[model samples]
Target chain A: MFDTERVKLLAERVRPTAPSRTRLLPVLAPLASLLPDGGLRRGTSVRCGAGPHGGALSLALALAAGPSAAGSWCAVVGMDDVGPLAAAGFGLDLDRLAVVRSGPAHWALATGVLIDGVDLVVVAPPPHPRPAAVRTLAARARDRGAVLVVVGPWSADHELVVERSSWHGLAEGAGRLQARRVTVVARGRGAAVRPVRRELWLPTATGKVAAA
Target chain B: MTALPRLLLVECPALTVPAVEPGAGGDEGGRRLRLFARVVDALAEVCPWIDPVRPGVCTLPIKGPTRYFGSEGAVLARVAEVVTTVMAAGPALAGEGTAVGAGDGAPPVPPVPPVPPVRLGVADGLFAATLAARAGTVVAVGETERFLAPWPVDVLGDPDLADVLVRLGLTTLGRFAALPAPDVLARFGAAGARCHRVARGLDGELPGWRVPGTSRHLLAALGRDLALTEHQPGFWGGASAADERAAEVLTDLQRRLGPEAVVVPVLEGGRGPADRCRLVPWRPAGTSAEDDRGLHGRAQARGGRASEPPWPGRLPPPAPARVAAGGTGERAGAAEVADGDGAPVAVTARGLLTGRPARLSVGGGPWMPVTGWSAPWPVEERWWSRGRRRAARLQVLAGGSEGRAYLLVVERGRWRVEAAYD
Candidate 1:
């Protein structure tokens, strides 16, 4: 008969787990060395709500391409036609990539399913009218165990606000004319890690991330 | 004897009305949320030619239906009948105050009157339909081309295509479709090809029809229909009753799907690298069976982002309902939500559910790993817009077969679950 211990082991086998110790994956860093936790968590959601063309999506694409390059299936959900060009520019493998064109629910459903099958999944969280959906999606990720990346420009005028306790400007490259390096610092997640800063580069080929 | 095709673009902002209500409480509530859905069904009832529904995106693939109806006029008549029937049953079907009367004053309470009159505009092709809907002018067949000829090219929403059309000095769809296909493709790319299709009345020619509107996947109800209540705290305070109801719904799903069932959330925002997904073990409130034990091993699925809550440091307050239940209905039957209008109150949790977990294939062999590992992948794009480009990023994947499976990102190495492949 199946008991709690056996059932627990079976469940653990199906649901993927996070690496015990944080390790930086090898990759060219534009902000700094890779995060100490390896990368984004598998089935939760994280957002880069900067602005239009504010590097939110670019960040998401960068994050998704890393695992996808390693032969794991990766999916770009909800983004219509906008994905292929971006993926190609980064020199990430598209063969392992699938773009699903669907409405919000379909997008959510697809993202939820792909979370298990692919190495990474990214979704675009549209600004308001349905913030509840975003919350539900967050819980879904928790239950299903998929890395959920939610990025979009934040707008308070629309009644949607991210209540932050403090704000430290993320340092981007310091050059005579343009920014060459970028770093993001958090002031309040319990423990504080120094802001990471690194010069950014887009490699010309896949399986290669040498300093530019 | 070649003839130009009539095209129509219908823009019903009212179609977005359904989004106003949160979850499907009942079938009546669902109907109230999307009255057009009833009209679609009524059309099918009256004509039997209307296609089955696909959620999201409005344009119905009506070419077959139009052909089957014998002409565009016949199709229009059928649509009108559907509209009329829905309006006629508005008060009786959707409930009080939902149906508008001729003069207003809220249309006289319960047993409400029929639906109010509606305005329509028809023209040839997508643009024409859009224009007609905007103008409240419905065109008769054969006159579509003439009606559409004088409109501006900006209506299509593609400036590049518009500029090219202007350079070519081509103004009308009828004229544009007359041009060679190769030239259009060469000069304008995909947009040009699309324009040609619209001009030829072949725009919505794709054979299948997608149902328009969102459907909820999770539904919840307590034993013996307890009084459903809402506890809206002062601004982001304790979890609303809705949140509680939803949690129960999630627990039920996890139990049924096994601990391998992953919960992926859509996290809010961040600056430096943050976790987008994570996994929550399938340990519900009271039960942990050995069958559940075996299930927990499969937790290696995507979770959600690891970004600090936008609330920052201040944790989200507790929710009202502790757990919810999944209604014993299939996806199709579940599509009819009944919550607000005397129907059962149920919350729909929408996400992808899979019957089998992900298996990594190596050299024709399928392998399932019990270890969760993640690496960071960086992305930066759009240097041209706003003079700001994306900083590099790191993506992480996690989860182990013995307990959990997940994908996470470590931009600079801070981690969070991105999704659970349950």
Candidate 2:
């Protein structure tokens, strides 16, 4: 027996006061199940490590692909030889992507500057990095609300390790390489303490990420 | 907008000093400036208000000259005669190179240096007038837009803007002018908006078109100041807040690290992964005008159809995640490829492997069993020069099913690891 006009008016009035969307940068649909939050939480750090068979760089590039295509600026630091065409194939918008090459001495300084203005920063830590520098960078990233993706070892909120990888479309001197299949084991702290495993095509036939 | 001033421009193509050599106190640069000053002084006799646009170019208000000389054509002829005479007299003063004093005990006649071409034109504004001078045509007052229609957008002297415009299919001024003003402002920022106005003939000037401190250089060469006040153009204030913030941080980083340390990727047409993209130093707009002008032609060539052709024999996708830093083959790591019998493998003349690759060692590392590999793809480049390269590529999967993938190349009986799929 309620008046329909009154109900509609009341709904509109309450809608404006509803909580805003969570401050999470989106990841590709296929990668959603691998993370506890289903998206990258800003102001946190993620570590990507390689296993006996290396696929760490590919995984990092794929993770950056999502936010980059969504109009966020991404920078790659300390990886002097990172291939740009491959980054482009992984769905990153090259126009917004920058590459900063720094020697071991200035690696942290360069990465620190990028994290200030850039939305997402992917850095490869130098060998035997100073503990103080690592702590300072993590704290800065948190304060600036920027996501830091470390390619090498670092204690972070989440850790994604490439457990195993295999290539498809190649044989004994026959066909060419077309795609890569990998197993990523993701683990994190706090609410994301449970470990999760994902089987994915890091780069499928069209150079894009998809579930296997 | 108010009507732009109609002006006449004269250009000496050969007399202009290269912008790269600023404050060029060198002998050649000084000589050219002095010659140009002479040309300006000669033109002053015909029209009192002559403006030196650059080292070799000058302009004047054409209205008064036209009325005094009875027509625009008459004024152009007079200016042309005066400029030609001065340019022809320039080389005789340098007596060092051409036929030095004929040691014949007779009066020596210094050879005349070839006369540099002097072009004249008239248009409604300085931008159009400069282009008109280059074409050696006099554009009617109301026809500035029509005259600018067919010229390419690169003439705006902004390579980055021109590259984007060409990619968007607005190659000519008329097409660019057809776009609504507000949209250009929103998409391309203030610099683009200014160029858009110039394209539409709504504005008469563009930033960085005139050389700074030209009058000072003239005074130093002639020992007299023309009292020309330097015109300071307004700074661009149209960038978004995010852009400005990013630019500020990047500039700070550039100051800390060298300029070459920070780079951005530019895609180009080529067969190899390393060749397909190059990293150029990031430059914020409005800071380097001369460099931008120099890069204009290269940017256009890259963004045009010249780079659009599909390169045959290009490796199929899922390009390697890591490439050698240098495009040249020297930077690649030396690798050893052997057969099951431990004999070194080689590529034959027909682009075939002498034996099936079984074990591989990269950078003298431990050997790993090869799991899968592709057939050799022959690559022959620059055959006409001494740098001719005859090489073959093979995609090799090493270790095991859960292992690494690499792009291996062989040349002159030597193998190297050029890239990796990670």
Candidate 3:
């Protein structure tokens, strides 16, 4: 004597008012168009890599900047020499940022612990990471509603690659470095199946992200 | 045997209360105890190991704070600054006449008491440090005996022993210390023997010097126990629910991976990206709430300013994303810069490049063409000191304009990759 219609109505009434909205973490305005939902989706893992010319670390820091500025606790693991000044330049709240310098041996363990509590974790995974560790980390992030941004190769839900980058304001025996423009390509498995490309300044003259 | 710990003793003359009779002076004594508690609380910001010796005095081991603040002189200056600010703000915080009669409607503002000066001194041990504080001088290392030589025996706080010593022609500590230890022990018993050792600067403490239950008295005055029972979440800007959660895992990770494995960034004034920011070990809140509050208060004060204090030679914004781990030559990768003729490039004494950098190699890596580079920026640090360094920096663009960028530094004819714009 199960009534399918009544059950369906009850399920709708108990569901979140806007499930997608609550699940999304804000991103910078210029980088929003590159994401499917215009923000980082919680519990999702994203992989970011740099081209031969570098911008991956900056881009990853920029992505985390959104949540960190929005009062989320962010931990950067395996990046021992991460420049906090550059992170601050990218709009991260330095007060809430913790840098965990875990060696390759404890990289997975550290990231897993951080994922259990932190809102966003940007980790540089060790080379040849164990598949089991990767699976457990992704599962933990999902279960804990944390965002994982990997700075290396991984089977991620979304992938962002710095397709190309160029530094501006320097010449042979001339001016100092001032800014960098980059092309970031975004692709994912679900709604973002189609690849997306965006051109922006990874860091402008004032050390903040802006549209190129 | 390990050397006696170097202690910094701070004495507030106005707050000292007689240990023999508790609350003898009634309201005035209680007020002094309350004010002393506030002083101790404020000094906790400088270092957490402050030991309240009695009502008006405290001592802290200076070694740890010296290392953190860079030098003993700096620590002394900081302690002086903190104590002065606290003393200046004491009366208003303690409330002028509120304690006299709480139920009285709008009690008249009582006359403000003059703030007493705080005495700061450092020496080898507690006894010597206390004397040093009274004299307002620092006893040089291995010089405590010399510093204590001229002090009268009466300062040891034993009237009967001091009277007997004076009658025996041992008026000064130096004279009394000259007596053989066995002779002194044989002549005067245990207490006199201990006092003789203190005079010689061997022992740092004496019986009855530290008043028991001082913390209990302080707690009674402050109306709360010294140890906090629970943490106040969101007590500061970053202390939100998310912060509490993050702190839990971070602390757990620290326990597992070791404390040094986890760090939080502290921005400071310096010329280079690495110098501008420092990574310090993360400490859980509440356990050291005063320390955190002090640091955050300083940061917030800086934030209230118009702009950061300018470093004349600091690289223009757009700071490098990845700075080398160590300072100067420690972790920087060796780099070779060559000109179009393949000759090694160098920076001259006048800070001009001897040759245009056309190629570069880092850490024995494959050589990349340096398509573009900036003029050298000269850096002369600590020039007046013996460890002075003269170096030059160059911004090099390798591969192409859109290729990799590096911050290259040359010191003593050697070059290294100081940072990357990755």
lDDT of 1 by residue, A24-69 (tens): 2222244224344445444445554332113344455665666555
The candidates' DockQ values read: 0.02, 0.28, 0.40
Instruction: Put the candidates in DockQ order, highest first.
Output: 3, 2, 1
Q: Which stretches of candidate 1 lie over 4 Å from their true place?
A: A1-60, A66-191, A197-212, B1-31, B34-70, B77-121, B124-137, B140-422
RMSD of each: 24.3, 22.7, 15.9
lDDT of 3 by residue, B1-422 (tens): 13566889999875665652334334555667888888888887887656678888988778778877999899999988888787777664334545532343334334345544588899987899999998889888889998998999999888999999999999999999999999999988998988998899887878788775565466546655321211222333324546546776786566445657888887767777777777777876654454464356436634843576887787788899888888565688899999989999999999999998888999988889998899998988788999988998889999865689999999999998888998
Which residue pairs show collisions in model 3? A166-B402
What lDDT, from 0 to 1, does candidate 3 have?
A: 0.81
DockQ of 3: 0.40
The numbered model that scores best in DockQ is: 3
- Sort by TM-score, best first: what order? 3, 2, 1
lDDT of 2 at B151: 96
Per-residue lDDT of candidate 3, residues A145-209 (tens digit): 78999998789988899998988898778887888989999998777389999999989998899
Regions more than 4 Å wrong, model 3: A1-7, A190-192, B1-239, B289-307
Clashing pairs in model 2, backbone N/Cα/C closer than 3 A: none
